[model samples]
Target: MESKDLKFEEVNEGFNIKEAIDEAKRCLNCKNPLCVQGCPIEHNIPAWIHQLSMGNIGDAMSIINEKSNLPAVCGRVCPHEKQCEGHCILNKKDKRIRVGKLERFIADFDSNMGLIREKLTPKTRGKVAIIGSGPAGLTVAGDLARDGFNVVIYESEPEPGGVLMYGIPEYRLPKEVVRREIHKIEGLGVTYVTNCIVGQNITVDEMFDQQNFDAIFIGSGTAKPKTMNLPGNTPRGVIQSSYFFRMVTLNNNGSVGRNEVPVKVGDIVGVVGCGNVAMDAARTAIRMGAKEVYIIYHKTIEHMSALQTEYNEAVDEGVQFLWETNTKEFVGERGRLKAIKAITNEGEKVIPMDKILLAIGSQPANRIVSTTSGINVDERGYVITKERPYGMTSRKGVFAGGDVVNTPQTVVLAMRDAKKVAAGIAQFVDAKKLLEE
Candidate 1:
């Protein structure tokens, strides 16, 4: 199917009502609840499962909302096998309860029924300025807004979801799902200000002095794309997976236009690196009508960083793997990529391709640290935060979390860090207010 047509349909069909209830029935309602312990936010897994099994869908959603702000998104993107489902007691028998799927079912059902969770708290706490509207910033905004804090999110991009809106592909996590989740947060009185670069448009001091924001949470994620330092001039066909994703999935209002598809319909595409981004790139190329898609990685399958399910899906969709292969150079004609010079276990190999996508990694942009003072960053430029307040930067009342503090391995992991930072922000805001009084 064409990518344009596939954009609206999720890769995973998700669970219907009957499937969700049957999955919920598998939950043993463990006394110790290893699934809850396994969750980063400590969601009451058994409680929700019990509610679902008893057909109280609304009550089950209420239980999930108590601790999670993005149940639908998390259920689709989270690495459940390594976290929640992996820790299930039934997993020993290979029948772990589908916690993630059930969560998605409840959240989707709520959204389809137009059943919005009621506003949690009145705007009482002082204002907070959150930089970046990604997972971490959204979590902090959602958590604090529920506690009556007036929150304003300043997003650098035209839209608010940061990586979630741009980096991840539509097949994996649909844009409408993200918008619905954002809408829920907005219902809590969380205001979003897009196209506002913190360093360029406004300063941290201005947030305090002009905006009267009592505290600042810096969740400005790692936006700088990392390259492989390949020889020769960077070719036209070579691009970062993140950029390529933004081009394809940003609904034609983005840099990549429908008329200017990055990979030609019959082009051969090579994706370097074996992470989830690489899988996404390869699969997207297939849907875009690529002649062939190759995931070239230096390591073996077991050592690949991508989720097992993602890798399996890529293979099912006709993506080939050049395992134990190290890329050396991009050979091209007149600035357009033509072939790749690589070395495998058997030595020199040349793989001809029309396009090469780099899915190596990314680093935090220096815009925030270079523009602000007293915010300590590591040698690699990640913001350094204290363990006491969990995500407080060296500069008091200025906090950082998610990929800015630690490059998140997954969306849920970023949410975990942001949840702690939200609690710290609340405590800091309350204390700061007491001192002023």
Candidate 2:
């Protein structure tokens, strides 16, 4: 109900027909598009813009589909300022052609109009099992399913879309958009088995031996939230930003009740860290009617990991910034959070806060690797992936990408990793089947 009190509407809106066409027309269609080069997936920026400029929306969507399995999601969440738009020749002129908005427009237009019904490729290649339905998992499933591989996504959650469905806030990326992307992937002939977790209900070995899967992909993005072992610890009212994001989402979507959300109305919230997650937590707290929301970071603004735009918006939305501040201890009353003892550049200060959201960072969960052997991880628990196979694990026929293989990354980056892993899975499965023949 508190989350509902906060509109929870998507922040960015796609361009309308006229605006989209105008923005698309602004593109010079450079022979060597730096925007494409900047893109992790290297989408043909000029071509798609040209298509959109000419009013061929369907054609534009087709070109985008070539490189992205989650164009809509990318359009909504990708850090275009650091990537495509940042490289745009027009950005120097302060007139970058809203690439993200254009992409979002095309995707939204296509989805709303049912303009593209992709020809489903028959699953004749081989069976592939995908763990987690996050960006990485969805990308692998979509890519492989398109290549004639039978893909069955095993999601531990009741619904698919892993992190996309949970970690991200509704205001940033609406659940409907994630659902739409998952539906499109499903149309590619990918099967989804929800409430079934790998490494638990079924093991990677079971997927190969029992289910007859030729290859398996672990796209389980970092689920374990990292927290600092600080002084004056108390359990209640201290929440991980990831957990807060999930609970707020669940509460808003009616999946969970008000009692589940940690940040109550009129509460004073302090989020530790200054990444995008911190910004989200602070803003969400403000929206939830927090008396005050502060972002406490040990470094200055220049040292913050969150995008400049996000910081600016958070400030505009009334999020207070406690720069160069290090949290020393959690001051709690009766095992409940009451204040935070922190030291700042000026001097030591104690801030009264009801909930302290840890937006520090996260590491991969050992759940999947613990149950399956041969999948080696580093001292830090990241899966060891081979370069040749792109994202292949130490175990043959098993692959990993996204946060599990590398550090936790942006959705598009995870998608990019998953795409490479999809190619690797295809290659491995084909070679294995050939040898059997």
Best by lDDT: 2
Candidate 1 to truth, TM: 0.96
Predicted candidate 1 versus true structure: per-residue lDDT over 222-330, tens digit per residue: 8998988877688788988887777777544465556566876778899999999899988877777788889999999989999889998888778899999999989
- Would you list the clashing residue pairs of candidate 1? none
Q: Against the hidden true structure, what lDDT does model 1 obtain? A: 0.88
Stretches off by above 4 angstroms in model 1 are 1-8, 252-256
**lDDT tens digits, residue span 113-137, model 2:** 9999999898999999999999999
Model 2 misplacement above 4 A? 1-6
Candidate 1's displacement at residue 293, Å, is: 0.6
Backbone clash tally (model 1): 0
